[model samples]
Target chain A: GIQVEQSPPDLILQEGANSTLRCNFSDSVNNLQWFHQNPWGQLINLFYIPSGTKQNGRLSATTVATERYSLLYISSSQTTDSGVYFCAVGSNYQLIWGAGTKLIIKP
Target chain B: SAVISQKPSRDICQRGTSLTIQCQVDSQVTMMFWYRQQPGQSLTLIATANQGSEATYESGFVIDKFPISRPNLTFSTLTVSNMSPEDSSIYLCSVVPGTGAYEQYFGPGTRLTVT
Candidate 1:
């Protein structure tokens, strides 16, 4: 069985602050994804970085497969960014999910 | 880059009742995945339904309780049978559009509550 764990189970920050979330997996993975679940419960796929780094606007992610961990950085955060961020990894069709980091950005 | 739609966005069901959820993809795909997200919890893989073949479910998930049907390339259905209070969760379907490459696009999801 594969294990995926996210760091900082919960976080609260003022708007415009920067934060980092981490995901660690117990095994090698060929597929890794970062998702944001909004207040309305919509799973927004942020990145599919099994390795390397990618940037999308104020959000950026880096996954080091050899280290078996991934990092998600949110810069100049906004209130709309408030939600639960999840990291899931898989070597097959099944994706093992992490408990997620619940982030709240206050204005 | 695909449009996905699910029927009956939300529903309330009585114990012992079964609900069937339909997932439709705008583009054709080889496989569709079903997942469950309980209240205040992360996503859990339920099963992977491949067209023209029986679905392969994850551990702790049985075919009898969670039946999946992949009738075609773009359409799939997941039935939660013999439901109970624990069956109350958000059920979602996802697909790897086009060449797939392990990038999944998920549907809006069906919110089910069993009382």
Candidate 2:
């Protein structure tokens, strides 16, 4: 089993502000994913970056396998981005999840 | 990548009763997993449902309490038997399609409350 830790347990930002969330794993992972759990409790996949970097619109993620860490960036955030962001890492048979960073965007 | 659905999006049940949650995936998948997320907590793996055989349970989770069935590649069911108030949580189903793709797609979870 691997240990996954997410930073900044809670964050608050203005609608147009930006923020970064980080996740650290204790072991190497074959799969790493960033998810956004919306206010309605729907888990949306933001990125599937096992390594390197990827960007989708206003969101981007970077996973450094060698360092056993990953970072997620949300640029020009909006009220729609107010939710919980989760980082999960998969090893041999199971996926380890972080405690998630709850974000609040004030309009 | 895959459209996943769960029946009975939310339910409230009495203690000592059993509830079965169904998971359906649009595409064929090789691995299906069941996870539990408590309030203000992270997700924990309950078990891995094998297509034709018994499920592989994780530590701290037992088959008798959280029985799982994987009849085929595209569907599975998880039953919480003899549940108590402590069993109240959101149950989610996830699937990893084919080989080489390690990313898992999650179904909109079933929110259960035991009274």
Clashing pairs in 2: none
TM-scores for every candidate against the unseen true structure: 0.96, 0.97
TM-score of 1: 0.96
Which one wins on DockQ? 2
- Residue-wise C-alpha lDDT for candidate 1, range A61-100, written one tens digit per residue: 9999999999999999999999999999999656889999
Off by over 4 Å in 1: none
Clash pairs of candidate 1? none
* Residues forming the 10-long window of minimal summed lDDT in candidate 1 chain B: B96-105
For model 1, the local distance difference test gives 0.92
Q: Residues B13-93, candidate 2, lDDT per residue (tens digit)?
A: 999999999999999998999999998888888999999999999899998999899999999999999999999999999
DockQ of all candidate complexes: 0.69, 0.75
Model 2 per-residue lDDT tens digits across residues A2-86? 8999999999999999999999999989889999999888888899998999999999999999999999999999999999999
